[model samples]
Target chain A: MIERDVIVKGDAGVHARPAMMLVKEAMKYPCQVMLIKDDVEADCKSIMSVLGLAIVSGSRLIIRADGEGDAQAVNSIVSMIEHNFKPHEESAEKN
Target chain B: MANNRVQLKDFLGDTGIIDLQIRLVAGSTGITREIHVGDINRPGLTLAGFYDFFAYDRIQIFGLGETAYLHQLSEPEKKEVLEKFFSYDVLCCIFTHNEEPDSLFMEYADAKGVPIFITKKDTTKFTSSLVYLLNEAFAPSVTLHGTFVDVYGIGVLLMGKSGVGKSECALELVERGHRFIADDVVILKRIDESILMGSGAPMLKHHMEIRGLGIINVKDIFGIRSVRDRKRVELVVILEEWEQGKEYDRLGLEDQTHAILDIDVPSIMVPVRPGRNIPIIVETAALNQRLKKQGIFTARELDRNIRESLKRENKEE
Candidate 1:
C-alpha cells in the first residue's frame, strides 16, 4: 500500500460533485481503498461516504491505496488533488 | 513502540469516568495478579483469561470478589503472590465486579505509574468488550495512496495530475456500483511487512469537495456501509491531459512503474480527453492490472506474437 497526505485545495472542498468524481475514479481499481479522518474511516469509492465526512477546503486528507497498482493509484490521486480536480483548467489555482 | 492509548469510553462504556485512581504496588514487577469474587469457573473467566494472557504490554491480573479479604490475606501469602508478580518483566492487576482496591494497593499503583481501570459493568460484558477492543487495537495495518474503490469485484484507484478529474471519475464509479475509500488525501501506514494500510485524514474523514459543489459528508450521504477506514491499495491509473503533440503509448508494450517506499508498483497513464469515459477506462485499467499481476500481459503477449512472426519470415528468407 502507498499513502500520501494532501490538502483539499479546491474552493468548495470535497463536496457532492467532487465526492462523486472521486468515488468514480476509485471504482476503477481491484484493490481496497479507504479514507480516514481522525478516528473516522470511510470508503473512498462511495459518494455518500465522501458526503458523510463533510470535508472542507484546507482540510488535510490521507489518500491511500493498496495492492497491485497502489503506487500509481496514489500518485494519480495525489496529482489530481494537487491539480485541484479541475480536468479542464489550464492551471490549478492556488487557494 | 508505545501502546496506543484507548479512550476511556471504549473500555468503560458510555458512562462517564466518575472516578479514576492509580496506585503503585510495592512488590510486583513482571507477574500478573487479579482479584475478583464468585466461582472460578464463570464464563467471564474465559475472557478474563484472554486479557490476562494477551491484553497487556506486560503483566495482567484478574481479581474477583471483595477487596477486603485480599487485603486481609496472611503476609506470607501476600508476599508469595506479590513476589511472583514482581518476578516478571511487567505486571498488571485487574479488579472485577467494581471491587475497589485497598488504599495501599492504590498507593503502590500510583507510585509505580501503572494504569488502573475500574468499570461498573459485569465481568462477562467487560471482558467481552475488552477482548473486542484488544483485537481491534492490535490488528495489523498499512497505509497507501489512491482512493480505494470496489467496482465489479475490482479495487481501482484513479490517478491523474491535479484537476484531471480523479474525484469526478470516482463519483461516477461509485454510481456504477463501486465503493469509496477516500478523496484528495489519504494516510497510509505499514502495520506489517507485507500489508499496506490506507485511511483518510481527521478533517477530511467523511468528506469530499468538488470544484463547484463544495464540501460533502460521505458517511451521511452514503450510510455506514459506504465508508471504510482502511484498504489495501491495488491498481493505479494516472490521468493526464491529452497533449496533441505528445506521444502517448498506443500499445501496452512498454511497462511503467512507480515506487512507494521499497515496493515498485505497476502504473498506467491515461490521457484526459473530451468524451472519454474515465471511470470505464479506470475500471478497465484495474482489470488489466489484475490480469498482468496474474502473468497475463496483453501487451507482452502481442509483442511476443510479432517477434515470432518476424522470426518465421527471417527463416523463410
Candidate 2:
C-alpha cells in the first residue's frame, strides 16, 4: 500500500471540477485509490465519494492506494493535490 | 436490450403472465415479427383515418367500438382505412370482449400480414393485464442469489455465498415488523435504467427455506403486513463469514457500491459470526440509507463539524 498527505490550495477546494478530475485520473489506474480528509475517507475513482468528502481549501488530504498500480496512482494524485489542482483550473483569482 | 422486439405468438402463448387465451384470426405468418413497444394502444383515433399520430409500434387493440366502426363504414371506406393502417408494420391487433372482426376485416388482415388476435376479456380488464405483461416481458432483469426484505420502507437485499445465514438474518428482520419480499432467489428487473425492482420466484412467493427449519410461509405466519409482492431495491447488504486479519470499514465515511446488472447500488459488507445482531445492524443501515436519501449523512456531518472546530482552535492559537 502507498499513501501520501497533501493540502488542497485552491479557494473552492475539491468541489465539482477538482473532484471530477481526481476521479477521472484515479479511474485510469488498476488500483483501489482512496482520499482521506480528517476522518472521512472517499473512493478516488467515484465522483460522488470524492465530492462527499467536501474537503475545503487548506485541508490536509491523505491519498492512499493498494493494488497492482498503487504506486503510479498515488504519485499522480499527491502531485495533483500539491500543485493546488492548478493545471486543470482556469487561472487564479488570488483570494 | 429486451426493448428491441418480440414475436406475437410468444407474447400471447409463451408469457404466462397475460393469462389471455387469445387466438390468431389472420396473418399467422406475422407471429414471427417483432413487438417493439412495451405498451398496448386502443387505436381509437387511428381507426378514424387519422394516421398522423398513429402508434404503429404498439399492440393495437380493436375492441367493440372499432369493430362497430368497421361495420358502419362502406366497404370501400373500410378497406381504405384498413389498408392505410395495415400499410405500416402493425405489431398485432387484438379484439376484446369476444368481439371477432368481420370477414372483410379478416381478409384485409390476412392480405397485409398484420396478425389479429381475439380475447374474451373486457377492454378494461384485458388492457391492464396486457400492459402489465408487456412491462414484465420487456423489462431488463437478472436473477440474483439473495434474500430481499423491506426494512423501514427501504428495500435491503441480503447477498452472500451459500450457508452464510442470510435467510436467518432475514427471518429475524421479519420478526422485527419488517416486510419480506423474497428469500433464496430474487428476480431483479430494471424499471428504467436506474430503478431496480425485486420480487420472489412465483412458486416460492413469501416462502423461505431455512437450513434446519424447512420451508415456512412468511405471509401465513406473520400476516399480510409482513409480506410484500415487490419492493424497489435501494440498498444491498453483503454478509460474509468473519475473516480475521482483514481490514473493515470502521468509520463508515467512505461510500461503497455493489454492481448488479450494470447498475451500481450502495452496498455494505457485514462480517457475520456468532453473537452479532445482524438484523439490528441491517435495520440501522437501512435507516441510515433513508436519511441519506433525505440529504443527511450523519458521519459526514460529524466530520464537517469536527473539522470546523479544529480550524477555529487553530485560528485562536
Candidate 3:
C-alpha cells in the first residue's frame, strides 16, 4: 500500500469536472484507490463517492492505493492535484 | 459506526418526521450548540440541590412539577439553584405543557450560552418524540451506488458496475407495478442492531438514469404508487456480466451475504446477458426472500423430500 498527502491547489477546487478526471485517472490502475478527506474515505474510482467528499481549495487529501503498482498510482494522482489538474502534458505539448 | 450529534438548529427546525413543536424562547446565540445524547434528563432532583450523579450532558426537561417548584422558591434560593443548574454546561432546557421559565433561569441560561426552548406538548409526549428523533439523527449511515426497489413488498437492492443494467432493471420492475425507492445513490442507515433502512439521496430520489435515455423522473412518469421514500433492505441482487466458464449457484443451497458497515446482508449474484430477462429474476429473488423470512425454504424442502423417497426405495429393493 502507498499513501501520499496533497492539498487541493486549483482555484475551483474539485468540482464535477475535476472529480470526473480523478475517477478517470484512478480507473486506469488495477489497484484499489481511496481518497481520504477529513475522516471520510471515498473510493477514488467512483465519481459519486469522490464528489460526495465535497473537496475544496486548500483541503488536505490523502491519496491511498493498494495492490500492484500502488506507488506509481498514488504518485500519478498526487501530482495531478499538485499541478492544479492541468491537461495531460502530452496533449499540451502537441499545441 | 460513529454517533452523529444532532445540531440544536436542526432539531428545532425539523418539521417533517419528528415534530417536537418547540420554539426558541431564550438564548438564541446558543441554538448552534449540539445535543450529544438522545435521552432527556428531568433534573427534578438537581433542582433541590442534590447534584450527585447529575446528568448535565443531556437536554434538561423542566416539566410542570419542576416549573412549580421553581415558582415557589424565594429570590435568593432561586438564584442559588439556577446558578448551580447552569454551571454544569447543560446541553439545553425545555419547558413542556406551555410552561414558561422564570426570568432568573432564562437569564442564567442566556448568559451561560445554554439554549432554552418551550413546547406546547406535554412532558410525556414531547420527551418521547424528542428521544426518537434524536436517536434516528444520531444513527450511523453510509452511501452506496445502487438502485433500491420494493418488489412484491420486499426491499431489493440492485448493485453492479455502472452501465450493467441496474437502473434499467429497476425501471422495468417499476413498469411492472413495483415501487422504486431510490436510483443511482442509495443512503443506508442502520436503524437498530438488526434492521438496516435504505433510502434515496435527498436530491436524487425518484429519478433514474438510463444508458441512452439520460435521466427521467420515476415519480413524474409513473404515479405516486410507483415510488416509495424509503424501505428496509431485505435482499441484495448483484448483477454482473455473464462469464462463460464461471460457475453460478444452481441449487440455491448456499447462503451468500454481503457486509455493509459491519452488518451482513443476504445477497445473491445474477449474471446479465442479452437473452436473459433480469427484472423478472430480481422479482423472483425478492419473493423467495419473503418466503425464507416466513420459515419456508422451497429448495431445501424439495431436496429433503427427494432424499427421503430415494432412501425408502433403496430399502424396499
Candidate 4:
C-alpha cells in the first residue's frame, strides 16, 4: 500500500460536501483507499464511512491506497484534499 | 444540448408544476416521450402552414389564440395541419387556461402518441412559470460542502475543511435567531448569470450532525422562523483552523471572491481557534456585506480618516 499525509486546507473542514468530493475522487482509482485521522480509519469509497470520521481543517490524515495504481491514487487524493477539493482554481479577482 | 430529452413523468409532480395546475388531458400512455427542448414553442405559425423555422422538438404550447385559430379552420384543413404537425417528432403539447382542444384534435394527438397537458394558468402565466421551471430543472448545479444561513438579511455560506466546526458555527447562528437555510450539504443552482440559489440537499435537510452530538434538526428544535427552505447566496465565509505566524487579511482591504460554476461570489476567510467567536464574526461579516450593498465601506472610511489625521499631524510637525 502506498501512503501519504494530507492536510485539510478547505476553508470549511471536510464535511458532507468535501467528504463526498473525496469519496468521488477516490472512486476514480481501482484501489483500496483509506483515510486515518488520529486512530479512526475511514474507507474513502463509502461516503457514509468517510463522513462519519468528521475530519476537519488542519487535521492531518494519513491516506493509504493498496493494489494497482496505488501510488497514483494516493497522490491525487493528497492533492485533492490539500487543494481544498476545488475542481478548478478560482481566478484571483482584480479589484 | 437542446435536443437532450427528459421524460414527462419527471416534470409531473415537481414543486413548480403544482402552481401550473397541470393535468393529463390525453396520451397518458405516451408519458415516456422525451421532452427535448427547455424552450417552449407557441407553434401558431407552424399550424398556419409555416414550417420552415419550426422547432418541433420543443414543448408545444397552445394558448387561446392558437386554439381559437384551430377552431376557425375547416375540419379537413385542421386535420391536414395537425396531421402534418404530428408527423414530425415533437416533445408534447401543453394547453393553457384549461382550454380544451377540439375532440378531433385529441384523436389526432392520441393516435400520434403525443402527450397533452392542460393547465389552469393563462398562456402568459403558464409560459413564464414553465420557462422558469424548465430552466431551473435543467440548470447547471453543484452540491457544495457548506452551511447556508441568513444573517441580518444577508445569506452567509460557511465553508471550511472537514470537522472544522462549520456545522457548529451554523448551529450557533441558528440559536442567535438567524434563519438557517441548509446544513452539511448546500445545493447551489445558478438560476441566472448573476444569481445563485442555495438549498439544502433532501437527505440531510434541516439537520446538523455535530461530532459530539449525533444529529440535530434546527427547524424542529428551534422553530419555523429559525429555518428557511432556501436563500439567495450573497456572501461566502470560509472557516479555517488558525495557524500561528500565518498572515491573514486583518484590514479587509482587498476584496476576495470565490467562483462556483461560472459565477463569482464575494468571500471572506475566517480563521477558527479555541477563543474565537466565529458565529459572531460571521454575523458581522454578513452585516458588513449588507452595508457594502448600501454603498458604505467601513474600512475605506477608516482609511480615509487615518489619512486625514496623518496629514494634519505632518502639517503640525
| Pick by lDDT: 1 or 3, better one | 3
Off by over 4 Å in 2: A1-95, B1-58, B61-73, B80-90, B94-133
The Cα error of candidate 1 at residue B162, in Å, is 3.5
Per-model DockQ against the true two-chain complex: 0.04, 0.01, 0.22, 0.04
Please provide, for model 4 over B237-288, each residue's C-alpha lDDT reduced to its tens digit, 9 standing for 90 to 100: 9999999999999898778999987788999999999989999999999989
Return the lDDT, model 3, position B133.
81
What's the lDDT for residue B203 in model 3?
Answer: 52
Q: Which candidate is the best by DockQ?
A: 3
lDDT for A5 (candidate 1): 85
Candidate 1 Cα errors over 4 Å, as ranges: A1-95, B1-146, B219-226
C-alpha DockQ for predicted model 3? 0.22
From the highest lDDT down, the ranking of the candidates is 3, 2, 4, 1
* Per-model C-alpha RMSD: 13.6, 18.8, 3.5, 11.6
Q: Where is the poorest 10-residue window by lDDT in model 3 chain B?
A: B1-10
List residue ranges in candidate 3 displaced over 4 A: A88-95, B1-3, B161-163, B183-185, B201-227, B243-247, B253-256, B262-264, B300-317
The best candidate in terms of TM-score: 3
Over the stretch B112-213, how does candidate 1's per-residue lDDT look in tens digits? 545455555556665555554444445443333345566554555565544688778877777666777777666554444544445565556756666678
True contacts kept of 1: 0.00
Residue B82 lDDT in candidate 2: 78
Stretches of candidate 4 above 4 Å error? A1-95, B1-6, B13-18, B312-317
TM-score: model 4 vs. ground truth: 0.76
The better candidate by TM-score, 1 or 3, is 3
Q: After superposition, how far is residue A14 of candidate 4 from its true place, in Å?
A: 21
